[model samples]
Target: MSERLTSVPGLLYGGDYNPEQWPEEVWEQDVKLMREAGVTMVTVGVFSWAGLQPGPDTWDFGWLDRLMDLLHAHGIAVDLATATASPPAWLVRAHPEILPVTADGVRLEFGSRQHYCPSSKAYGQAAVRLTRKLAERYGRHPALALWHIHNEYGDHVTECFCPRSAAHFRDWLREKYGTVDALNHAWGTAFWSQRYGTYDEIEPPRTAPGPVNPTQLLDWRRFCSDALLALHRAERDVLTATSPDIPATTNFMSMMRELDYWRWAEHEDLVSDDAYPDPADPRAHVNASMNYDLMRSLKRGRPWLLMEQAPSAVSWRPVNVPKKPGLQRLWSLQAVARGADGIMYFQWRASRAGAEKYHSALLPHRGTASRGWRETVRFGAELARIAEVAGSRVTAPVAVLLDWDSWWALEGADHPSARMRWPDLMRPWYAALHARGITADFVPPHADLTGYRAVLAPNLHLVRSADARRLTSYVRAGGHLVVGPFSGVVDEHDHLHDGGAPGPLREVLGLSVDEFWPVPDADAVPLASGASATLWSEWIETAGAETVDTYAAGPLAGQPAVTRHAYGSGIARYLSCHLPDHIGDVLDAALAEAGVTACVPVPEGVEATVRTGADASYLFLLNHTDRPVAVDADGTDLLTGAPVRGAVRLPPLGAAVLRRPHSPDSLDSPDPANSPDPLGDNRS
Candidate 1:
């Protein structure tokens, strides 16, 4: 077995292949082209359940068998598909109860993927049977490398409101609190004269548009996530029984809402995800990078697979924008640099017809000589060249803490600051770190942060008691901590703690928020740079903590928009307002004072990142803009196959990997201005 196909520290290539869609003649040609492109693995049968199991008892594995055999004969490893994404029409028609009923009381038609009710007994039985059948047949196959469960499990058009799902929701509530009284107390159902006397009286939260209760809607979201996790666990148990050796996983959509990934990761053998961001979007890098970090942290720093990336444009979004030249390669390496062990795209070949005909692939409609094909070849060759060297490398000395409990709590609150939006507040801090090439993991709040020198907690609305203790201890031990404005407002149950703003973190952060000034719009209070903070919402005040910066010109001019607190040997900084470029610079300078250095020393528009291992270090320098950038060379240039003695310029959308000699003290290396570039590319 090749290490590239089955081990850590070796990159795996290739992606979703639908050889069954094309003629047998094209299959051989596809294999030859894949080999030439350095492709090593293929994912099969993701959307083929409708074609495979047409009836409850009927299964046509002939095509799958032949497909696997053909791939195996070519020495291509197979990520065998479970064919559970879309159930067949017969199953839906036979058991109409399996259909999902939306929140609006409309019964969804069985037309797309993820349409089956996860809580339905019929669906579970059928799914388990199909999974067992597939596993029993392919469990002993020599070509099987991994098991890819339902494709992008929660990215579908249905939300279940059927009676079965409602009953499951009730049962889930029972398990969560062990009694209806406890549940009623947590939900505060008595407020609107909505009290449940019996289990049957409780229903999944479904409300029409207008004057709805936020608590009810929040509980419904929580219940639905739990109900779906049960389905995942059931399927996982079936596969684990049949083929215990093979790893099983479902692809996650980055930063998705419906499914609780932290809980889902507990049942998966490995984490995998699909990433598709708009090419023209300015926040594309942060969006993709945050998702990669979230996936990596889900398994506690374990490597994950980039299961489905767009080789070009995706067809589903209203606007299908193509990735610019070198963009795909940059994003692929971004995943690997973050901690991905494998890189693959959605479709290996362009579909001749259907919903995704416009999706990009290695071999476009014009065949192998086109721009898409050439870019794929170049990316593949580069991946193969560094496949062995870049495997299993980890990056960064700092990590950011992210918690699902906090996410749920923030959204679950009835009195949540209308001004606070979680994603918007978190993105800027994440982007600031990414621009400097720092690799930060998104660990849960409960994760141990003792190893990290700095911890950034953005919009930490929910603060558990234990987490507060841990954070206090971390800061007291000389570690730096950053807390965003709306942090520490609620407890685990989404209720105000009655102490003050920030609850338990109030004492640790040495700040108590007395009032919040909600800006009417981005123009209401602009940054010092004269740019409006587009998504900024609330500006808070610290009653006791020392003010670091105030609004430059506004009605609340001298109010504390940013504060700092001294806690033992360390310091805690609280950001109260949405900081545009000017305020962001002040915050960045504050972080520098706390002993955190920029991951890369380049100017804006150029993205810098570093990945390291015990024996090697790799620095990534990328130009994110359309125009070229002149960068000072620092080490051996892996992409250009040359080293520069001083300043070097990179073309538009260019990227390079600089390999530096490893040292045990690399993490503690002094300022770059004092240390010479060991590879003779120093710049004065």
Candidate 2:
């Protein structure tokens, strides 16, 4: 963590504040209200591009200057935006080519946010111009805490098929393959007659015939992510040159499919995620926690910021549901307990009129008298008491492998079936681990695996040679591993591996697949342990592995469904079939074999997570159940500040933070400048 983050007095509360939306009088009232509600900082100028730059080459700073000074006067820090999230009407009118083109070649009209194409030279220059201006103007300002770059990239437009982007994509392809022939070989263009004579012949895989070349699609995804990351890097360089002190970052939509965050994460000084879990799902917290862990893992366990979450209800969903009285508090702390240093919401005061008028905020449209505002105040005050947790980190001995390339390629149209999803399969395993009170970090294929005692890989279908070798080395080095079925079936180029499926891992997995059964037309296939599986079932034969589970009935009757292979001091558990949401019994046995155990067992729907501080580990027990749960643990409960005996009781939607002794000082992170973290020491 940087001093810029830890220098704050407490958890950084508050969020995107639109002082421009209200009158000057209301601005003062909002500041007072924010301070009263324990808001330490606010992100300003997120959507103020149209307002800040009314015309081409025009700049307006009168209203914004006063607001910044006013916020500083009130002792509130500022996460200032360059207001380049959306290009102004005048700029888009002047440079119409900056508008992004859809896959069908339709130019997206202006008025909506993020309409500019990332590869447009004009758009890139204009964005940097505004950003440099902001850095120069507010570099040393008292309230300037951090620099907020352009809002979420590729959220609306993942890739633009415009000529500019196409040219950029071709350039990227040339850089990767060195020659058009090499690219053809990698893409396996033999069957499709896609042999390109020149790099320029390639275009963004846009609206192509029958799903497009899977390799080209994956490359297009890579290009889109790189193009936007290039923009961020350009602005970051400008900011660093002008400011020299302020750290730069952008908010990431945790689970957004566009833009490979695994690659984008390296450019950030510290990671921040905007999460909005569905209230309709009873187990929304599990999904939220998974995203949090992924965000924290982006920086390799560095403290991250909860950039934007709904204070109460979100407006964009089909049906807006208000969070129950204490749900907001429960969710916000959920992020913190999982290694987030700060907690901020989408907005401060609710908008009086706009597209997001219905979106909840610290001070809602109903004003401070409402339940939303009261809960916001209560959560903020609670944050004030726990300021020390800002630099602390949660220690987990398990890692869930996450690969963006694999995710993109695994669900390609040319696959056996499109019924499977990478996140869908990974979520169940993560939830099973989380249920056991064993928090996990999300690791990329290339990340160091020494710290983790075990690694769970749900579906790593698109395995690169180097990465496959890395996994093999990890297993040989005494690291327990769990491999799901249908993995390692394809090389990095999205082509089928030679000979058969489960290519490089055929040796490591100690099994070979002769054929794959698609689970009764995408329905569940019964297993011997009473567990059911969907998506795929591989007819397998083990070389030197032991069968743990088998199919009860089917043509592949009594076949190995799950296998265990011992290598070095570790054991590899391979599930030769897809699994349903419920795999508790199997997961429990796997975890136990790896010597991983939960801090304490809780009733269903209750979560247990541990964050390590300087002198002790803070155990967070969250009760998501409607009924009260009995918790058994030792330590001082932070919520009540009381001692807990043998079995303490927690009400529904309640939480208890337990402080217990552990290895001292858990604050450690790989510096942003360090390309690969070599200090792979496990904290606590």
CA lDDT, every model vs. true structure: 0.73, 0.83
lDDT of 1 by residue, 568-608 (tens): 88878887666645445644755675666766577677777
TM-score of every candidate relative to the true structure: 0.91, 0.95
Model 1: lDDT to the true structure = 0.73
Model 2 lDDT tens row, 568-605: 77788898777866566777777888788776788888
Clashes of 2: 0
Error of 1 at 331 (Å): 2.2
The best candidate in terms of lDDT:
2
Error of 1 at 458 (Å): 2.0
